[model samples]
Target chain A: MSIPQQLILTFISGGIICVIAQLLIDLTRLTPARILVLYVSLGVLIFAVGAFEPMQKIFGAGVSVPLIGFGANIAKGVREAVDKDGLIGVLTGGLTSSAAGITSALLFGLFASFLFKTKSKRM
Target chain B: MDSKAKKQLIKKHSPSTTILKNSIMAFIFGGGICVIGQLLSELYSYFGCDEKTCGILVTVTLIFIAALLTGLGIFDKIARHAGAGTLVPVTGFSNAVVSQAMDAKSEGYVMGVGAKIYTVAGPVILYGLLSGVIYGLIYYIYRTVEQMI
Candidate 1:
């Protein structure tokens, strides 16, 4: 696909995924936290079925930007690890692959907490 | 009014959500975030990083920006309107961690910030890792069986 086309697909796919989450939020009692957990697990299950790659290929960051993509990444990491290191990869691969994202979030989050105070939501 | 009638009255009077409008906002905001990610990935790729490195960099950059916004109190403001638009992306994950930490800063570092930082996002990480392990084991067995056969 062309650059513009790929970007458009990314936008559409990302938008659609968020829309589904919105619908869940609006229509159901599921909290945002639960929904996020669900999405991540859904990503893992989708990958388990061997479908996440093609979806990523088409949607690009749309599929990859969500927590679902994170789940899939962990699964992917484990798979690769298992292949290369035998059974030990089952325990080591997921965190190993996701270390960059997880570590960055933790470091940046801690820094932000020091630099800024929380504001009460404006009623 | 009787209890049943009071319940009916309360349910009737409560303000209803603007579902259509919220969905539209979510789509726009969520899609916009992804577009930004795509652009960032492209930029990194142009700088000669491999695809995997670019993906990692894009996530790191997004998380950093999200953490900043959450700290500045801007992300929640936007999230008020964006709803799941803000909540569904990786940015939302960053917000969860940063917001929780900031909220608990009053209780000091270890007992407060440390304990509470993952209160919200812990499930995502925990379940994410759990499912990955489960799937990995399954995949390993399947592959092994395939090879044996």
Candidate 2:
């Protein structure tokens, strides 16, 4: 696909995903935390059904920028590990694939904590 | 007034959320973030990295930026208007960890920053990993069975 087309699809997919979550927040009692959990798990389920790759092929980063992509990444890691190492892959694959994300979040979070103070929300 | 009458009175006076406006904001900001990711991926690919590497690089770069924004106290302000546009992306995950760590700073580093860092994002990691493992187990068994047949 052309670069412009890819970016447009990414934006639409990402926007639609967020809109769905926004509607859930405004229309229901589900907290943001719960919605995050739901989206991530949904990603894993989509991967499990073998639909994640095809959807991603079309949606590009739109499907990836959201937490669901993270969930699918974990599942993808597990599949690769299981293929390579049998039972142990189930134990190590998820973390192995997600290690980059988890570690970056941790290191950056720590650095930010030292460099800046939390500000109270301004209304 | 009776209890039901009081409830009705309160409900009548309470302001309702403008759902349409919030949805439009979410669409713009959320989609904009993804476009940024796409651009970053394209930049990385232009530098000769393959698709997979570009994906990882884009994620890392975005997380770093999100952490910086959270530290600068800007993420939450944008989130106020963007709503799930910010919350639904990987950047939100970074903000969750950084914001919690910043809040717990008063409690000291180990008990405060270290332990509290994952308070919000913990469930995401925990459940994501659990589901991945479960899926792996099922996939393994299915593959093995198919091979035997």
Candidate 3:
């Protein structure tokens, strides 16, 4: 696809994903945290069904930035690992594949804690 | 006031005007973040990183940026306006985790910061990993059945 087309696709898909979350927030009692976890589980299901790659290709960051993308990432990792290393990969693949993102988050979290004193949020 | 009267009064005061603005802000901010992520992925691909590595790098970079912003106290401001726009991204995960730690730093390291850091985000990790294992098992079963066929 052309650059503009790709951009449009990304915007639409990303907007839809957020809109769905917003709808849940408005219409239901489910907290955002719970919805977020549901999105990840949904992502894993999408990945298992082999639809995630197509969505990723069309929407790029739109799909990939969402929590569902994270689930898909884990699914992809495990699939690849299992193909190569059997059942062991099932256990290790998710962590190994997601290691970079997880580790960076922890490291940055620690660094932030050390550098900044806690301040109560002000409305 | 009667209970029904009070309910009506609250509903009357509910800010419907804010919904349009909130949705628009979410679209713009959320789309903007995704655009940046797309650009990062494109850059990594251009640099000859494999697809998986490129994705990992983009996620890591986004999380780092989110954590930094949370530390600087900017993400919260943006989040207040952006709503689901900011919350929908993986960066939000970083923000959620790091902000808790930062918020708890006042109480001390071990109990305050460490114990509470995952207060909200712990579920994301726990459930995400659990779903990963489940998906893996399903995939394995599917593959085995296909082979038998």
Best by DockQ: 2
Q: Please give the distance, in angstroms, between residue A81's alpha carbon in candidate 2 and its true position after superposition.
A: 0.7
Candidate 1 structure quality by residue, lDDT tens digits, A36-81: 9999899989988999999998888999998888888999899999
Model 3 ranges with Cα > 4 A deviation: B1-17
Every model: Cα RMSD to truth: 1.4, 1.4, 2.2
Q: Ten residues in a row with the worst lDDT in model 1 chain A?
A: A114-123
Residue A14 lDDT in model 2? 96
Interface RMSD of each: 0.8, 0.7, 1.5
Question: Which segments of model 2 are wrong by more than 4 Å?
Answer: B1-10
What C-alpha lDDT does candidate 1 achieve relative to the native structure?
Answer: 0.91
How much lDDT does each candidate structure score?
A: 0.91, 0.92, 0.83
Per-candidate DockQ vs. reference: 0.86, 0.88, 0.66
Q: Compared with the true structure, what per-residue lDDT tens digits does model 2 show for residues A46-120? A: 999999999889988899889999999999999999999998999999999888889999999999888998777
Clashing pairs in 2: none
Instruction: Report the TM-score of the second chain of model 2 against its true counterpart.
Output: 0.93
Q: TM-score for each prediction?
A: 0.96, 0.96, 0.91
